[model samples]
Target: MIPPALRIRGAVLVGPQEVRDELWVVDGRISFTAPTGTAARDVRTVSGWALPGLVDAHCHVGLDAGGAVDRPTAEEQITTDRAAGALLLRDAGSPADTRWVDDRDDLPRLVRAGRHIARPRRYLRNYAAEVEPDDLVAEVVTQAGRGDGWVKLVGDWIDRGVGDLAPCWPADAAKAAIDAAHAAGARVTAHCFAEDSLADLVEAGIDCIEHATGLTEDTIPLFAERGVAIVPTLVNIATFEGIARGAEEKFPAYARHMRALHARRYDTVRAAHDAGIPLYVGTDAGGSLPHGLVAAEVAELRRAGLPAQAALSAATWSARAWLGHPALTEGAPADLVVYPADPRADVGVLAAPDLIVLRGRPVAP
Candidate 1:
């Protein structure tokens, strides 16, 4: 149940420079002013430095390395993310139907990208709707209709024949599929880890790219010019070395390619940011990696050259705005996180939030 009207006192860091002594939550929505007819004794009080709930823009909830998981596992993943103060989750894509989460008030709010559409045998087994170029447009429309305003595509993957990363969809097919998604009222994003696919996807009007490790001087401008966003998922990219080593025996060329990409990942992200490409925090959790690493991902962003405040914004105000969610605004859902110190000075404080309030209820401490 919604807790009694809450009075959040102390430093409420609504923005980089905006601060307030206190704020109130009445009936699960934020109220800049106190509510009427509420006794002082009846309102609950919390104190700390508060920030809008963090966002994970490219996470996967009902998915694991093997594929779609059971409901209980999905619930566990959701709880883990909620505990980490990730109150808004943009589920990048998943094979399972997670519509049941909408009814859960205590769970983190989700914006799903129905499922990953990839070329046959190009993606993780059982994790995508694999189809040929002829079927691309139809699948894009189908997933766009199924998702919450977004659809995902696997733009590139390792081509076993060539033993190297290659673009999955031809330019014509990509353009047709993207147009179809747009017509269906959904924005499209893609999983791209190679340079060859960047131009085509950007030219085709894709809204965003996930694990954009291949971004370089040539393509960064195209992405920025097109107003497309990128989620670096630095935390996930850190595993590239291990992935390369695992494939070294069978695919030496692919191994070298992965290592090269991993070595220059920081430079790629830094260049993208320097070129005005929109960067957001995405831990890429729920595959082989565990959930609740939003803090780590923000730290990684900082390490990749974003200032402390900018890095924090990747998971906070900026991210929420991009995802079409409100942040610490009047009449918005009262989802926020409290930390012991100023996060702008050092983002590491996000690792241990002092309190987490979701939908007006204090859910963590």
Candidate 2:
């Protein structure tokens, strides 16, 4: 039974624009977004912010489950993280590598990008889900064919022992991967940390660039022309460097590179915004940071010169749009999130939601 829908009246923050009114969630989809000029019965009052739940476009909850793939297994950590992450999820990452979450989930929804398609020996092999040559095309096709928004390509991998950058996919291979995903009606998101193999990804018509660390000036305009989004994950990189520097008692040159890239991420994102090129928010959390802390990305985006509203939009409405859900019409599962302050004014307002509605039901989990 679709219980009597609730209405949150106050700062009706919907996709960056704040409306001083009340919003009704009838049977899940937004029933009415009207001014709260008068009070009515059965109206649940929330004196704060209300907007679409955030879509963390990129994250690696499973990858952070530190430990070797030994016989002991990391099933618990993987399952727990994914389940917990779902409570406020719009998380995009590979679910194949991590122990598959087999929980009675009613929280965050998973729109996986699946296993990263890369060469056998690559820079991210330690992190990637590992797609073998024989199953590479099929795997890419599988995720894309299922209408799972995007296909993730591991174009860069961190080498074992040496800790150097390794090119994962050649231009031809990347082109093939993109073509396969395109054929399946999916966009390809390339993980690029250096300029060495970036040209191939751009030339192959990949949809988005993740961790725009090594993007040259020549590349910035091409992304604009092709209408591909650039998702700069700077914060997580910085966070990782700090942790490594603290944990290892050494600040390697890699830390400097990540720091430089983080700065470049800000500059390029601003450049993209000014040039009318799309920039999405992504925090590659597995390598360093924690999951469910995606709001940092919004804050970073704002710091990068985007208006608070636009940054909020990139997290909410834009993210929903990215997932192909243009409208939250009736009969749609109730997926509502309530905040207590203007998220645009301070992206940190999202840290603690007053209420979260998932699948037409209130949280009892």
Candidate 3:
């Protein structure tokens, strides 16, 4: 493929506020970036500093069929043709990225851990097909082996005003899944919101915790010692009051669950940051959050006392690294965006991307 237009000169958010003097893309890799006089073919100046395309580590837009969630057999039955199979079906629960990338051409890329795995008749009760741990690992391994950035473990129903939630997968089960993923070179990301469930997941040796909740003074150091990462997804909880109030009409349990979700002391997140725990930003969109609105999560991290640049890196550079792409500089897949303001000073600029480059092609706005 022919190299798209090469971007040059502006404030590139590579690692915090470190802006290289210039940048350019060849075919699909960020070809050359250096001080003012960098050398490369097809030289044309791109107006703004280039940011590697945003990598939303926790998004779920794998396929279109997985949209209709929590519907009855009739609704879900017909919906099957739309989203029944396991291999695809993105689930409406994650509608945000469609707006973020497919609809607006905003970010470079967003990877997903697919639907959350839970026991039958639980929260993801409708769309998320629940299975025993033995079955779940096979499914998870199948997906993880596909070279996905990582694998997500989804239980710990306690976060919700949730059910006995079916006994969480036995520790042996969780570990088996974790081992399968690790053996395949993928880290496990769990969706936990309670201390007990978290302790179970921690025992499983997961690499990260998605939406970690009810963390105590003690839990922080354990994670630090193990070097696990935390993707608090704080904004989903912050705005949950509104989501619950709106959904109370249909999904009462959902409304109540959201309320409780918003109450916990993000102190866990704060402590994680204070203790130097790695953090990630995920919108948890679809069922709870609106799709394509990851910027709000970044803003929440900043509000939670994380530096603006740190929040930006969590979504950009750090996120990609967590997803297995350590070298986000030139020569990597060209996924980037150009915005009107300095992300370090004003994150609001993320809302309006002036230009977006994905895999080397700049989609004309």
Q: Number of the top candidate by lDDT?
A: 1
Clashes per model (N, Cα, C within 3 A):
0, 6, 12
Query: Which of candidates 1 and 3 is the stronger one according to TM-score?
Result: 1
3-111, model 2: which lDDT tens digit per residue?
5557777766544444646667654556565324332334555556666655667765455544124312334323332332223332345443432432444435656
**1-365 per-residue lDDT for model 1 (tens digits):** 32478888888878767889888888888888987774344787878788999999989999999999999999999899999999999998899899999999999999999999999999899899999999999999999877999999999999999999999999999999999999999999999998999998999899999999989889999999998999999999999999999999999999999999999998898899889899999999998899999999999998988888788888999999999999999999999998888788889999999889999888964
Error of 3 at 341 (Å): 1.8
Model 1 backbone overlap count: 0
Model 3 scores a C-alpha lDDT of 0.60
Over the stretch 1-365, how does candidate 3's per-residue lDDT look in tens digits? 33435765676666774677667676566755432332344455666655666645554453223444332322322222112101111122231223323333223333445445665544453445467667977866765744344666565663233432223678888888888888877767777766666666777888888777656777888888788888787866676677567778766765665566567546567778888888887756554444465677777887777888788877777777766663348577666777767777887777667776655666543
What TM-score would every model get versus the actual structure? 0.97, 0.79, 0.76
Deviation from truth (RMSD, Å), model 1 = 1.3
Which of the predicted structures, 2 or 3, would earn the higher TM-score when compared with the native? 2
